[model samples]
Target: EKSSHLSAALLGEDCEISPEQLYELLQYAALGKHHNAAQPSWCHIYHQSRLAGVVVIVLHEMSQLHFYKFYLQFKHLRKVFRHRFTLPPPSANFLASLCGEGSGLNPQGTAPGLISTGAECIPKSSGLQCDPIIRKYGKEKRGLTSYTLTSEELRKNDYPMRDSPGCKGYMYTECDLQRTDSSPLFGLDCEMCLTARGNEVVRVSLVDAEGQCLLNELVKPESVIVNYCTRYSGVTRKMLLPVKTRLPDIQTRLKKILPHDAVLVGHSLNADLQALQMIHPSVIDTSLLFARNEGRRFKLKFLAKAVLGKEIQCKQRLGHDPAEDARAALELAQFFIKKGPVKILQRALKDVPLSTFSIIQFSLDPEYVASHRLVGFCEKVRNKLTDMLTIYAGPFEEDFCLKSVKKEFGKCGPIQSLTVVTETYQPYVCIQYGVLEAAQLAVESLNGAEVAGSCVKVQRPITAATLDCDVLIKELELDIENEGVIYVAGIKKSLTETDLQEEFSPLKDLETLFLPKDLQSGKHSTCCFLKFQKSQSAADALEAINGWAVKGSTLRSRHALASGHLWRWIWQMNHSSEKQGGNSLSEKMAPLSDSITASHLGTSLNRDILHKKELSAAVSSIATPQQLVMVPAAGGSVVLLHDNTFIISQGEKTGSDVLSAAQDGTKHHIFYQKKKYTDSTASGGFLMLFKGK
Candidate 1:
């Protein structure tokens, strides 16, 4: 019935055909006969000899038929015919013939109401059957088969009013192809913004499956005042300013360049497509493809890090570069293609064999479990067999030493391997047993036992086919015990030997002492040492002095009283007592002090000045060693004892005798208070360079 209505429409009917006539005509056509035994009472008055008038009358009769009843009958017949005939039903091919050379309706030309062909014409065949002549000469040859419907079919089928019949939700069908020769795999990256002007796109980049960049352009928005935080795009206002090219122009250029049926690859393609207002059917969303059942919230960078073992550092400033982003999206798509579809989280659980016999209790309350059992508990998690085991052991030990533990655990179970997680406060061990029973035994017996002196915990493991064992080994090698010793420089000048020694005395009791020697000649050097009694103490000391500062005046004043002055006065009084044959100076000078009035006191003061100046030039000019050597003192002010000692006086005036004695080493004697003292000044306990006589 549908075929008869289509045929009558093609014949340019003037009146509608009834349901009864249409059904009879279709039955007759299918049977390869024109005998209408049950024809409707709608015959036109026209002679067959006048074919044009007869054709017009037949068309007028067909046009008067009731199409609604005919449609219902056609649907019923389709089901009945399909059930009766074991052969495949005729498709759109039956209708194709009537419109083209394959149709047997065509007749020799010069006759009215018939199509005519010349020497170059292809012959027509029967409309109800596949015409051999037209099939050989008129079928579509080199190019893609046209899936487009004709105007008559469109009107009859109510096309263009509904969605395209061939389109699937997210997939492209052959009928949707706008280009035939190009590859279907491509990538897209877009930058969008909502500004004061309006919603607009800022940039778009395209890349092929091979990671070769194809198109990159900055699009100009319709208006300005670009908002910095343009949703998740990370495009800022500076990037949109003075926009490069008009958005519409860029879109037009892109449409011309891109294949209509290509698969679009991107991190979040839905967002990009929405931004660009592109309605593409074929798309590969990396985020969607890699999402775990844990949630639909997988980040692109995280997926890349886990799957590819490559870190992608996202730019924190400004707009994202279109070319780089597009390439990354393409790379992610390619990785998934090579690695196969990501396994669902629940499916990964199946890969991990559960131990039936060793049922361990897991608590959601970490604090309560930790306090009661003295053992840590992790939430029951679903991971690959290897990964779960690794995570289970991670709380007890480092991953590197897991092999040794695996060997020991294999005695109870057919252990394949093990992984220890060092991230937890307590060590965790994950064991992969060859059998589920062995895994059960291991988890039951070793869950709270100590392995290699550290508490051990057991669980299942996780595995990914693409996970690199060699990379894991490299990471394990870096987990060995590391001892770091940091050397710090740039100490303050005022820091004295005693100050440093006292500060680090606690450390010095633990390690050896090695002092730095000064290279230049000076009483003031910028370094000191606190030898630790132990190596660990050195580490502690280093931590303490990492940024310590010395505070106080560095230079001693010339006339100010100091501890050295009191010692010098006592030494003089002792020498004076020795000269008096054990008589105390307080008693000897007691009687003379009243009247004698010490006539040599003035001369003695002058002579002391001359001795000090002679010692200054020789002592201060001497060259010292390169390294500053700190000598440990018994108990006194931390003095920097140089090789040479030049006495430093606190008084403003210098005694003449002492000054002259300092200059002349030939006669090293000096007179003070009319007493003759031996020329023993050079013989005193002083740090000095000796000259061989």
Candidate 2:
């Protein structure tokens, strides 16, 4: 039926144009091609996703991407500006009225058709932050369980309608959702007003599967209503002060109306449930349901426009109509079911035998890919996973999923994606090996191996669109080779950043200096990092600082393994050295083996600054000879950290999640999970350095 409608809309009754011509017309419009023009001079390629739930067409011209992207963004910016400045506001009378279709209680209980007679709520088009044509891969069968219907189908269904007693009681009797089965599906929405404690629910709207209002009411709060939130909530002092409907009555009413097993659908459903103090197992949050991997959930109105091809939440003055919100959520659920379910949340337990969820979960979360630290690792892993391996059912009691494939060949090389289809009875696994040899090694070793009583079959599978994996791995690598970090410690307590910068402003290749402090650490020791554009300049400055003492501790510098790993060394400076006796770390100091070389350190200065006897005493320790040389390979540049440890990784082990979210995470540091930003000062402890004269 849909195909027929589309065909008629395109070809017309007499078939004015050929189907090939129609296809070309669409291509020309999409690619911004002109009539009678050959494809643009630039060489380009196009690919598309054949997934059932989503259709993604990707076009690429190595030379013209940025040019097109600029225009695309500019177009979106125009929409945002129009939405902000050009959208008309509603009249004062409409603003003061209740959001009900009746404008209040109606004798017939039939609310007016949506707020359309005077002012329509729909937008002219999509604005900034448009929903992408995205859908997750899953085993959902095409035959719809529910949420698919036409207006005729919905009217024919034997569900309750506006005249139904339950529907008659609601402010409006409209049903937008349709389900054939007796199993219950209800859409719930709530509007909250400011109360003494916080925001409290002032209105609730519940709609049945067919969108006939089951319940709609304004309830008085437990505490005094502080602000009506008249603009957004639409609830005014006039609606709640009379207190005709109390919280208890609404709670009791809902208990009787809502079934235990009914599937609840709503946007931001958690807040509604919390406001109601309701515990429900079956819920489909439209916000979460429509959430794609890269984009955040949309406002109900924006979502309606983008996904449902409808508009909502535009009437600002009439308090929010719960019935409208509920209908929107119910319809949104139907829209989600029409596409597919999100299965990413059902991740398998770590290292368990491969299940459907386990296969996709094996790859790092997209968050890891977005980080500077993991890009190189991702690139290396992708380069190795060029070959594919197929795992066919063998003597294994279970299906042919990664049953023992990983155990058998995980050592062969990194496995990038282990695609498994266990939902079907005939299960097969597609394994993308990080290295071609790894796949070959696995095929050679495991093809005839006996497992769970049967010998498993292994071979390579045909491949396509591996460019996705390539794109995944082709993120920016950390630029550590060209830059160096200086570890300056024992900064005077009295000095501010201005004082330190003034002293070190002459250093060449100086990029930024930052002071870091542990938010949880009460210790007041000052430490800072000096980042330089050139590694050689850092080396020269470190050499100079070693010969002269600043404040108290010797200044040190070293090439960072990567840009973001500075915090690991800073963590070591304050915590690790103290754990090991400070004296022991001082004893293994790399500089003690070399003689002082600074000509500026004249005799009188040396006597006052060097404190050789005190230094010797500080270096003395009862540790063994093997422990004496256990210094890190920074060439004795670590002035504060313990001498023995090597930074094996700067990942979860360092409690990076906690540190990166710390008070100074982005400002004193370089990044954020929510955003990427930088400043002149490095975040965290403070360090001081000298400018080159």
Candidate 3:
């Protein structure tokens, strides 16, 4: 029946039996009277379990003796059951209950008695004597135990199934024990039942005094033949199937690598040790070391995040690297070591008032010197004078601030005092120069000076008033209409109002102008403001004069000068032009009525004849200043006049010229050209005229 079920399961046939039912059926058949009928009378039921592909049954015949019968169908389950049950002796009634027998029944029909069995053999009775050799060598003394054996001795000793002829357990003898001054330590990580599928150690790792490393290794399980969760571990059944090294072999290798006196270090080291079947007395679990509650229960990632400010996880693609994990664990251990186990335990106490007091005390301890030093330094910096500038020199250099200040400003005068402030932040020394001059010199010279790869800023002390004023000015300046109003000392003297008007005339119509006020008079009378007809005109005007200069006579020039002064007025009237917004006179004049008064005119010109009179005035203005003058392109048309010679003219349409000979060598002729006028009747009422001699 078992064979049939195994066949059905292997062939994927519809076996009517459920897994539980199949287990029961197998259990019944293995322990049933029909199967036990062939057994000898002296064979006492030692152990039984439904495991692998069979009913695992062990019979103790006599002293130092045990017989094992395994059904091949469940051979795999048997090994698994044996591993789980035999290590720590399983309950005597566990198998009986599984076989549908009452725990009260004595199946072997004999009272249990102690039997002396070596580590290699299974005890026949419940009262088994501990092996003296094992007790003497395996007992942990000074946190160390010796388990050394020669290759020949190891081959001769029986281990896994202690009584089995070929199996050998770890061997140790008193003669092999070596005492060392070094502290005992070990690292532990586990490949659990889930990870052990198909006999593979999918999750192998190590933990040490340093940390835990989730190493990558493939192990072949003796029971299962395939891996179901390959996507997670990146280990496939094909990759693991070929590697047949048993768990004992892997355990032996680990034991050889780890120091004998080393205490296991890990997050949950017990689980790992148990899985690997390593029996060690000394272990240091970081979980216990960092436990915040009843026991160490925090996840590894959580501990890493809270304590170390790092994120780590086993679910990552590369998985948890064992080396890094080991290192992290070790760091955590060291942190606890430095903090002291007693302090951590004290923190774990539940008394609210006591905990708070303890916390306060801890914070005030000398161990917090770095933090206190930083605070003190910041206080010193805060109390520094606002007018002074502070420069930070390289860290670890004493009196760096004072030294730098003296070195830079010592020649000028004796410094009041240079204060050096040192604190927690990477090394920096603050040097406060005594006076503003000294500070200014230091700032100008040392602001961006590099010392030991770090650039230092000579920072001016900030105060509430200064900071607020700066903020307000920055806000006001955001919409400053005139950047040209601001000036430097040497540049302001050369920039009179006339120069500004001449330069900015192309920007807008200059309706009014002002100049900067004199500081001595304490009046708003120096700077100028030329208001345009529109805000757009003003904006354009300001944009045009963004880079204009101001000429100043004094060493220091006030950039913020008041407007509407005499110098500015005279400059604007003499140097300003009506051609402010446009390039062509026609375009500029188009906005004005054909007949308009020039309010600021320098002459008594009639409104109707203003254009002709202004043209004559402009010509006279230029001509009167020169010996012989020619007014080319007057009023947008060419005009010429040689002294006492002729008045040559070229109109837009009618081409005409006039010439006059000199009346006297000392006197020049006054020639005039008059064109003939015609009436509306077009009857040639006037003719073109040129008067010349």
Candidate 4:
């Protein structure tokens, strides 16, 4: 009892319990205090007075929590009674030796030498805990069950990742993802050869969680082979001569081979997905799982030898065998899951050549991963909120040509359309791109660049609207339904809808043609939008007639990206008209009875061209008693309203006069001068003038 190794403080007021009491204390804490029970809630766990199993309960602390232990025994087979119990001192003390000397938990323990008590629940600097500083910024709380790579990890690895559907030429692994550790694991590896389009998959290998080969196939690249890359890929022309599988065929096969809940495991897995042109919903990148210093990933071969205690990718072989590499990766993931991170890190330290354990230590912090995810999410949001997809570039010293603008902005990315609005005092061009990155690049690189000896300011339009204009435009452009439609800008103003339909309908696969009209002007702009029955037809049209000269002007064609904006504007205008108790343009045109005059016939030639027939039909439907005869003055026409207020209409313009002729109590009469219009062009109607008496 007086051993020098045992400290005198441990024999003080604090009473130590036996190992059985310690277990009973943890069981009591886990079961919690449930009041008003006929029998103990934990009684079910004890069968015939023997502990069969346990129910694990997770606990969270908002404040300091302490647990005490007591023994419960049945008395006389009728009721239970609590035995005497003791609570530890308020300060930390070795309550009992729960772990043996060879327990191996001391290295990760909060107190290296003492038994871990409730004090271990309190976070320590050296222990693993969820960081609280950035908890509110996360979209969803991190759960222990999730094994897929975080958003930050996916971006850091440059994986072909997608959060939504409708991205062209990419297929998703699952329509609805089940993010849990229970999903099946599939190891994947790919080898690539250089091609005209860059790295393309030459071989792919897949293995299940048990290291059984599921698929191994050789693929042919669509682009011409530029380099065999045999040094690393081990692919040569002779080996691939008989291979008929291509990327699409591989994609189809992989889709069929993989289950809906499978989780892909690989080292630098994004590279393989990119080479194969596929997007997986769930993944575990071994590079991130076993991190190195400063975001640098250890070579797959290095990890295989260090962690698995087995050598891989021997120098004697020509290149790595994908099936072997895939199995190695699969085992590494299984090891990490079974042994946990702390034990794995401790084991890796001995074999690690590096002087410090900082590499694997940093990956253990959940906050680091969460922060990276927050940054990536913020970046995506900023891109979505950006309005730079369309830019205004103009006020040129001289009229600029389409070719010049195309040459300048096309360097950034593919342009969807270029609209030249010359009707204003200072002419400007609206440049629309198929993606936001191109528009951002243009804004940064060419915002103040000189064009035609003048500095043109390139920026987003200053107008604000209720919807995200850029997102709608880009989404509509990439939609499969709009693939065959092309937006033709700089069309000759002289051409009509009938002219456009006749010109394009003769082409193969032509379906429908649409000519959009300005909402305010009620006349077609110098643009034509047409849809072909097939997407190939639209591509062919662009090649054949994009720059062909017609009616003294050249046509510029691009895949349509902003048709939704036009349709929305038209709907809003029609809706507003209906709200004001006026007939909508789509329902019935506004009557021109108040402004149909000689001055309008000559001055407003192209004005309201789309509504001329509708207006005529509306006027003809008016009752004869409601019709009024009036003389067309040289400047405008005058109309007397029912309230005795007068309005003057000049051409397509109209204004009301506030003069109160009704206060004079005078009568007005209209008289026609037939002789005055005898030599004039007003043949159907006589010239009539009104005078108040």
The best candidate by TM-score is: 4
- Candidate 1, which segments miss by more than 4 Å at Cα? 1-175, 178-183, 197-199, 230-239, 313-317, 342-693
TM-score, candidate 1, is 0.25
Q: Regarding lDDT, does 2 or 3 come out ahead? A: 2
TM-score of each: 0.25, 0.31, 0.24, 0.32
Q: Assess each prediction's global lDDT (C-alpha) against the native.
A: 0.38, 0.42, 0.36, 0.52
Write model 1 residue lDDT over 1-693, tens digit each, in one string. Answer: 122222111100112333333323322222221222232234321221111110101111111012211323344433332111011122333232222233343323111212211101111112312222123223322221121223443334322222455322322223246534233567788877666865667778888878788888777677654554454455656665766687666656666766656666777766675556545544556665543222223455544554555545454644466666677767766654443322221221112111000111222435443532321111101122223223254343222233346545654433344433323444454455432223444555567777765675565433452154334323222211111212223334456556655655554443322223221333322333333324465566556664464463221101101111122232233354567455332232221110111111111222323343333332232234322322211111111123333222222213343344346344334322332323333122112132121
Report residue 109 deviation for candidate 1 (angstroms). Answer: 94
- Order of models, best TM-score first: 4, 2, 1, 3
Q: Give a tens-digit lDDT track for model 4, residues 430-492.
A: 776644445655666677898645688888765453145555445545654356777665556
lDDT for model 3: 0.36
Relative to the unseen true structure, what is the C-alpha lDDT of residue 415 in candidate 1, on a scale of 0 to 100?
39
Backbone clashes (count) for model 3: 70
- Comparing 1 and 4 by TM-score, which wins? 4
TM-score for predicted model 4 compared with the true structure: 0.32
Stretches of candidate 2 exceeding 4 Å from the true structure: 1-139, 142-182, 259-261, 294-296, 339-531, 534-539, 545-693
Give the range where candidate 4 is weakest over 10 consecutive residues by summed lDDT: 62-71
